[model samples]
Target: MSATTQDAVQHHDHHGPEKGLKRWIFTTNHKDIGTLYLLFALIMLFVGGAMSLVIRAELFQPGLQFVNPDFFNQMTTLHALVMVFGMIMPAFAGFANWMIPLMIGAPDMALPRLNNWSFWLLPFAIIMLAMTLFLPGGAPAAGWTLYPPLVLQTGDAFPFMVFSIHLLGISSIMAAINIIVTILNMRAPGMSLLKMPLFVWSWLITAYLLIAVMPVLAGGVTMLLTDQFFGTSFFQAAGGGDPVLFQHIFWFFGHPEVYIIILPAFGIISHVIPTFSRKPLFGHDSMVFATGSIAFLSFIVWAHHMFTVGMPLAGQLFFMMATMLIAVPTGVKVFNWIATMWKGAITFETPMLFALAFIVQFTFGGFTGLMLAIAPADFQYHDSYFVVAHFHYVLVNGALYGAFAGVFYWLPKMTGHMYNDKLSKIYFWISTFFINVTFFPQHFLGLAGMPRRIPDYATQFTDFNAMSSIGAFGFGLSQLLLVYIVIKTIKGGEKATGEVWEEAQGLEWTVSSPPEYHSFETAPDIK
Candidate 1:
C-alpha cells in the first residue's frame, strides 16, 4: 500500500473512543471495559454491603429486631453470593483487564469482543439473582453453598438462582479463557512466562483455576435445576440419591473458589509490597511455584469442608493432611513478603497499609483455616460462627483489602491523578479497625457455640454479637469514603507522572499517565 493510504488506516484505528453510552456499550477497548467492571463491582460492593448490615443488624441484639428470620436467612445467602460473584470476582477481573495487557506489553486482551460479552453477562445475571428476593418464596436461603433438600425448598427463586449461577459460570470461564490466551500468546518479545509480573502470573493461575472448577459448579447447579424441575433425584434420598453426593460436588468447586477469589489479591500484594519497600521481590520464582502449589492443594482439600458430614477415617485423614500441607506454600509466600520488606526503604502509603493488613490478617485467616483443617476439630467448628469468622478474614481483610490496595496503587495511572492521600488513610484505618471488630468477635462467638445462620441467638452470645454488629455498621459506612476518593481522583487532583510510584516497575509505568485510547498502537519491547 502507498504511504498515504497506510497512514490513513493508522489514523482511523487510533481515534479516541466514541462519545456517550455507545462507547461503553459497543466499544471493545480493554481500558473502557476495565472501567466498566470496576464501576460495576463498586456498585455491588455497596449492594452486598447493605445486605450484610441487615444481617449484622438482626444479629445485634438477637431478638429478630430488624428483619424476620426468613428474610434474615435470605440476607445471609444473597450476601455471600453477591460478594463472591459480583463484588470480588469482577473487581479482580477489572484488574486483569486493565493491567494484564499493560503488564505483558500486549496491545489488548487476546479476545477483546469476548471480553465485552463476558462482562455484559454479569449485570443480567445479577439482576436475575436480585429479582429472586421478590419471588414467591424469597431468594435461595440454603446459604451460598445452595445444598439440596434445603435449597430444593426454595420457591420461584430456585430456577432464577440456578440460571443466574450458570450465567456467572459462563462469564467467568470466558474471561479466564481470554486471560489465558492473552498471556500465553500475546506477550511482547522477551516477556517470557517467568519474567511476567507477579500480578500477571497470579491471574494466569487464577484463570486456569476458573476454567477448571466453574464447570463443576455449573454442573452441580444444573443438577439442582433438574432435580427441582425435571424429576431428577440427584440428591433426593427417597429416590436413592444421596445428599452427600451434592456436598462432594459443591465443595469440589467451593474450595478452589476461595483461591480464585484470593490468588489475584495475592498478586496485588506481591506488586504493592515490593513497590513501597523499594526492593525487588524477595523470591519471585518461588512465589510462582507456591501459587501453583496452593492451586493444586486446593483441589485435594475440598473434602476437609465435608468432614462433619461423615467420611471414612482414611478419607478424612488424607483430606486433613492435604489441607494442612497448603500451609507450607502459603507460609512461603508470607515469609517472602516479610523478607522483601526487611531492610528496605519502606513507606506506609495507603496501598502499603492495606497490603500490610492483608498479609497480617490473611495469616490470621490461614491459621484459623488450619485449625479447621483438623478433621477431629472441624466436627466441632462446623456450622458455627467460627467457620464464618475464618473465611471472612480471608475474604474481607485478605482479598477485599488487596483489591482496595490495588485501586489506590493504580488509581493514579488509570485516571492520571493522584488520589487524596489523607482521606484514603483515614478510610484505611477506619475500615481496618471496623473489619476486625466485625469478624474477630465472631471467633469468640463460635467458640462459645453460637450456630451460624440463626436470626436469634442465646442471651449468652449477646455481648459479642452486639460488638460485631456495631463493627459491621462502621465497616459498611466506611466504604463510602472509597467511592468519594475514587470519584475525586477521576474528576481532578494533582497530576501524576507516568511512574506513579517512585519504585514502580513495568510496561504500564512506561506509558503516559491515563494511557492513550488504544493503550499501545504498537507493541512495547520488553527487555
Candidate 2:
C-alpha cells in the first residue's frame, strides 16, 4: 500500500468501540447505535414473520382453521404494521447508521442524541401495538392500510394502534432528518457528491422521500382519529364526507412508501454487484438518475391503487401510463446489474446468491406490477391473491432477500468472525426455493379469480392453498438457520481480516473487522 493508504489505516486504528452496554444503549456513537438498530430490526423481523405464518396457516386450507375473521384481520393488520414499521424500515435505518458514516469517512451521525431517541421510540411503539391484541375488541381489524369507515368501526384497540403508528411515524421522520443532515454536512473534507458511494447517494434520496411523505401519513391518520372521536365527517358519507378520500390521502403517502423500502436495497445491490463482478458499476450515472426518476414517479402513481374505486377513463389512463413509466427506470436498473455481471469473475457468496435472486425475483414482481398497472386488467386482479403474490415477491424476494444479502456480506466485518459458509449457502438455497414455492402458485390462484381478505376459499382452490401452505411452513422453518448463523457469528468464529471480501473496495474496507464504535474519528483520504 502507498504512504497515503498506510496513513489512512493508521488513522482508523486509533478509533474503535469503547466498552460496555451503557455505551450501546446510551450511545451517540454511530456504530454502536447502528448495531443496536440492526439487532432490534432482526428481532422484529422474526416477530413479524411469525405473524405472517399465522396468516398463512389460517389461509392454508379453504377455511379459517386457526383464527376467526376478526382476529385474522388483526393478524393481517399487525403483520403489515410490524413488517413495515418494525422490520424493513428499521433494517434500512440500521444500514444507514452503520454504513453511512463509514462510507463517508465521518466520525458519527450529525445528531447522535436524537438517534438514540429515535430507536428507543420503536420498542415502545411496537409494545403498545402488541398490547392492542389483548384488548377488549381484540386489536384493530382494519388492516394495515387502515382506511376510515372500517377503521372507525374498530374497538378500543384502535386508539392504541393509532398512537403506535404515530410513534413509528415520529421515529421514521427523525431518522430521515438525521440522515439528511449527516450526509449533507458530515462528508470528509475532500469527498464530493459524485465521489460518494452509491449506498450513500441512494439513502440521501430515500431520506428526503421519507421526510416528505411520513407527515402525510401522520395527517391522514390524525384525520381518521378526528372522524372517529371528534364527531368530524372527514370520511363519513352520511355527514357529507367521502370515505374514498381517505384512500386518496393514504395512497398519496403509501405509493412513495414503496420506494422508501426498496431504494436502499437498490443501493445495497449496487454496492454488492460491482464488488463481486470485479468491475466498475455499469451505468452508474444512469442508476442514480433512474432512482431519482422512480421516486418522482412514485408520487403520481398513487391513483393506480384506487382505479377500482371509480375514476374517470382519462384519469385511469393517465395513472396507468404514469405507473407504467416507472418500468423504464426500473428496467434500466435491471439491465445495469446484468451488464455488471456480464462475463465477469463472479463468486456466489451468500450475498451474491441473494442479489442474483433479487434480480430475477424482483423482475418477476415488476412484471406482475406492470400487469396490475393496467387500469382495465387491475379491475380483475384488484383485491385478489394475485396482489398478495405480487407484493410478497417484492417484499420477501426483493427487500427481505436484500436484507439477507446485506447481513451475510457484512457479517464478517460487523462481528469480526466469519460465518459458516456451508450453512449460509444452505440458508440461501432453501430460502430461494421455498420462497418461490410459497408465493408463485398464488399468481395462478389469483388469476383464476380468488379474492384476497377473505377467510375462506372455494373447493377449487384447495390444492394450491395446501401446496402454498406447506411452502410457507418450509420457508418459516428455513429462517431458523439464519438465526443460528447470526448467533454463532456474534458469539465466536474464525477471525476475519479488515477487508472481509477480497474484491471489496471502499472506505469501509480500510477499517478493521467489527469496526470501531466511532469509526472515522479522523477522516481518511478517499483517493
Candidate 3:
C-alpha cells in the first residue's frame, strides 16, 4: 500500500469510537450527528406521513368523517410544518453531516459541539409545537403559510407554533452556517472549490440561500406575532395594513426555501446517476450553472405563488415569465441525466431505481408548475386540489424520493452491512406504484374544481377521492418495509466491501464501509 493509504488506515484506527448509546447522545462526531439527524427525520417522516393520511382520509369521502373541520385544519397545518421543518430539511442536513466531511476529506465538521446542539434542539422544538394541538383552542388552524388575519384568529397555540417555527429556523441557519464554514475553510489541502463533489457544490449554494432567506421567514412570523398580540396590523387591511404583504415577504423566503430542499436532491442525483451509469456526468459545467440559475430565478418567481392575490398586468407578466424561465435550466438538468444514461452500462440497484423515478416524477411536477405559472390559468387552479397535486408531485415524489435514493445508495457506507436487495426492490416498486396512484388523480380533481382545505366535497368527486385515499394508505403502509430494511441492515447482513457499488467513484468510495468516526485523518490525494 502507498504511504497515504497507510496513514489513513492508521488514523482510522486511532480515532474510531467505542460503540454505546451514550456515544450517540453525548457525541459531537459528524457521523454520529448525521445518524441522529437521519433517524430523527425518519421518525418525523412517519409522524408527518400519519398526519397526511388523516387529511387524505377526511378527504376520502364527500364529507368529514374522521375529523372535525377545526381538527382537519390543524392536521393540515401541522402536517406541513412538521414535514417541512421536521422531515425534509433535517434529512438534507443529515446528508450534509454524513457526506460533507467524507466528500471533502475533512476529519469532522468545523464546530462539532454546535452540531450536537443544533440536532438536539430539533426534538425539543418539535415537541413544543406538537404540544400545541392539545392546548385549549387546539393547534394553530391557519395553514403552514400562517397568514395574518387567519393566524390571529387562532388561540394560544399560535404563539407556540410561531416560537417553534423560529426555533426550527434558527436550527437550520446554524446548521447551514456550519456547513458553509466547513466546506469553505476545512477542506483538505488538495481539494479545490470546483473540484469538490457535486453534493458539496450543491450544498454550498444551498447554505448561502438558506442564510439569505430563513431570516426573512423569521421576520415574517415575528410580525405575525406582533399583529396578533402587540396590536400591530402588519397584515390587517382594516387597520391600514395589507395582508398581501405577508405573502410578498413569505414567498420571498418561501420560493428559495423550495429550492433549498430540492437542490441537494439534485446534487445527490448528479452524484448517484453518474456512479450507476458507469460514466462521467454529462454536462458537468452546465449542471452547476443550472443549479445557480435556478436559485437566481427562485427569488423573482415568488409572486407566481401569489398570482391570485392581485397584481397589475405587467407585474404579473414579469413574474410569470421569470418563473417560466426556470424551466430552461431545469430542462438542461433533465436532458443531461437522460444523456448520462444513454448507452451506458446501467445497473438497476435500488438507488438507481429511485433516481430514475425522481427524473420522471420531478419533471412531471416541473411541467405542472410551468402551467401554473401562467397567471390566467392559475386563477382557476388556485387553492384547488390541483395545487395540492402539483406540490405533492414536486415535494413528495421529488424531494422525498431523492431522500430514499440517498438512503439506499449510502446505507452500506453508513452501516457496515449490505441491505437486502430483494426487499429493497420490493419497497421501491410498491412505493413508486402507490405514490402515483395517490397523487395523479388529484390533478383531475383540481381541474374539476375541487377546492383544497375543504373538509367536504361534492358527491361527484367521491370516486377519485376514495381511490386516492386507498393509495395514500398503501403508500403510508409501504414505508414499514423501509423501516424494516433499515433495521435489518443495521442488525447484521453480508459485510459490505470498501467500494459499496461496483462503479462508485469519489473520495467517499475510497473509504471503508461504515467509515471511521474521524474519516480521512490524512486526506487522500485527489487526482
Candidate 4:
C-alpha cells in the first residue's frame, strides 16, 4: 500500500463516534447509521402495534364499541402504513447497513453520505404521516391501498399523505442505490458473487427490486395527487379515466413490494438455520436460483390480488397459473430449510425457534395464498378476513419472525454481550402461541362470510372476534419483553466471543464482537 493511503487509513481509524445526539444526526458511520435505522424501526413497531390494538379493541365483541367507524378505518390504514413503511422495511435496511459491509469485508457502504440521508428521510415522512391524524379528516380512511375516489375524499391531510409517501419512496430508492453500488463494487479480493453470504445475496436482489418498483409506486401516488387537485382524470371515471388502471399500476408495484419485504427474511433464515443446525446450507446454489425465480414470478402474479375485479377469463387463468407458480420456488425454500436441519445437531435456540415457526406459518400463508389464487375461489374470499389472515401469516410469521431471528443471532456480535437465553425463549414461545391465536380464527371468520374493514360486525362473528382481540392484546404486549431483553443485553451481559455462534461462518465472525468503528480497515483476503 502507498504510505499516503496507509497514513490516511490510520488517521481515519483513530477517531471514535461523537458523543450525544449530534453523533446520530451528522455521523456517516454505517454502524451508527444502522443503529439509527433499527432504533427508529423499533419505535415505529410499537406505534403501529398500538394502532392495531385499537382496531382489535374496537372489534373485540361488538357493534361500534370503542371507536367510530371512520376512526377505526383510520386505525387500519395507519397501522399498515406504520408497520410496512415505518417499521419492517427500515428494520431490514438496518440489518443491511450493519451487516453487509461486515459480511462482505468492506470498510462501509459504498455511499456513506447517501446512507445517512436515506435514514433521516424516514422519520420526517413517518412523522408527517402520523400528524395527519389531527387534521380535519382525521387520517386517510381509505386503507393503505389508498383506492380512490374514496381516498380522494380525504380532507386537508390528502397532500400530506401523498407527499409523505413520496419522501418514503425517495428514501427507499436512495437506500437501494447505495446497496446496489456497495455490493457490486466493494467486495474484498477473492469474494466473488457466488461466494458472498446468503444475506448479502438476498439484499442485492431486494435492492434491485426496490429500485425497479419504488418509482412505480411514486408515479401512482403522483397521479393520485394530480387527480385530487389538478383536474386530471387519470383515475377518475368522470374524466374518461378508468380506476382499474390505478389498480393495475399500484399492484404492479405492490406485489413486488411484498417480495421486497420478504426476501431479506429469506436471507436471514438461510444464515440462521444453517448455523443452528450445525450444517452448511443444503442446496445453496439452488437456494440462490430459487430466490431469483421467485422474484421473476412476482411481477406476473400481481393480478391475483385483483382477480375478483372482473378480469377476462383468459386474464384470470393466466394470473391464476402464474400465482400458483410462485409456490414452486417457495416450496423449494421450505424443503431446503427442513433438509438442512434433518439429522443435524439441531439446537432450538431463540433464533432457530423463530426460524422454524417462520417456515411453518409462512407455509400456512402460502397455502392460503394458493387457495386465493384460484380466481373462482377468490370470488368468495376477496376482501374477507381470510385474505387478512393470509397476509399476516406471511408478514408477521414470515418477515417479522425472520427479523427477530436475525436480531437474536447477531445481538451478541452487535453488542459484544450474550442475551439471556431464558428470557429470549420465553419471548419466542409467547409470540408464537399468541400470533396464531390472533390470526388463525380469521380464516374461519372469512369462510363463514365475514367481511373485513368494518368497525361493527354481525353478532355471529362475536366469538372468534373476541378470541382474536384477546390474542392481539397478548401478542402485542409480549413484544415489550423483546425491548427489555435487548436493553438488558446492551447494558450488560455475558461477554461474547468473536464468533458468537458455534458454527457461524463469514467475514463478520472474523471481526471483534462490536467490531472496530472502521471494520476491515485493511481489506480481508478471501481464501
Candidate 1 Cα misplacement greater than 4 A, ranges? 1-9
- lDDT score, candidate 1, position 22: 96
lDDT, candidate 2, 1-527, per-residue tens: 36466557677466444576676767787777777888888888889889888888988888668889888888888989999999999998998999999899898899999999999899999999999989899888888889878898888898888889899999999999999999999999888988888888889999999999999999999989988899999899999999999999999999999999999999999988988888889998889899999999999999999999999999999999999999999999999999999988888888999999999999999999999999999999999999999999998899888888888888898899999999999999998888999999999999999998777889899888877878888888998889899999999999989998886978888899988655676678767
Please give the lDDT score for candidate 1: 0.94
Candidate 3 residue pairs that clash: none
What do the candidate models score in CA lDDT, each in turn?
0.94, 0.89, 0.92, 0.93
Cα lDDT tens digits, model 4, 314-432, are 99999999999999999999899999999889999999999999898999998999999999999999999999999999999889999999999888999999999999999999999
Ranking by lDDT: 1, 4, 3, 2
Clash count list over all predictions = 0, 1, 0, 0
TM-score against native, each model = 0.98, 0.96, 0.97, 0.98
lDDT of 1 by residue, 1-527 (tens): 15456557788677789999999998788899899999999999999999999999889896878788899999999999999999999999999999999999888999999999999999999999999999998998999999889999998899999999999999999999999999999998888899999999999999999999999999999999999889999999998898999999999999999999999999999999999999999999999999999999999889898898889999999999999999999999999999999999999999999999999999999999999999999888999999999999999999999999999999999999999899999999999999999999999999889999999999999999999999999999999899999999999999999999996888899998998877655667667
How high is the lDDT of residue 222 in model 1?
A: 94
The Cα error of candidate 1 at residue 395, in Å, is 0.3
Q: lDDT by residue for model 3 over 1-527, one digit each (tens)?
A: 27566776675467556578878878989999999999999999999999999999998888769899999999999999999999999999999999999999998899999899889889999999999989999998889888777888889898899899899988999999999999999898888888888889899999999999999999999999888889898898989999999989999999999999999999999988998999989988888889999988898889999888889999999999999999999999999999999988999999999999999999999999988999999999999999999999999999999999999999999998999999999999999999999999999999999999888999999999998998999999999999999999999999998899986988888899988667777767877
Which one wins by lDDT: 2 or 3?
Answer: 3
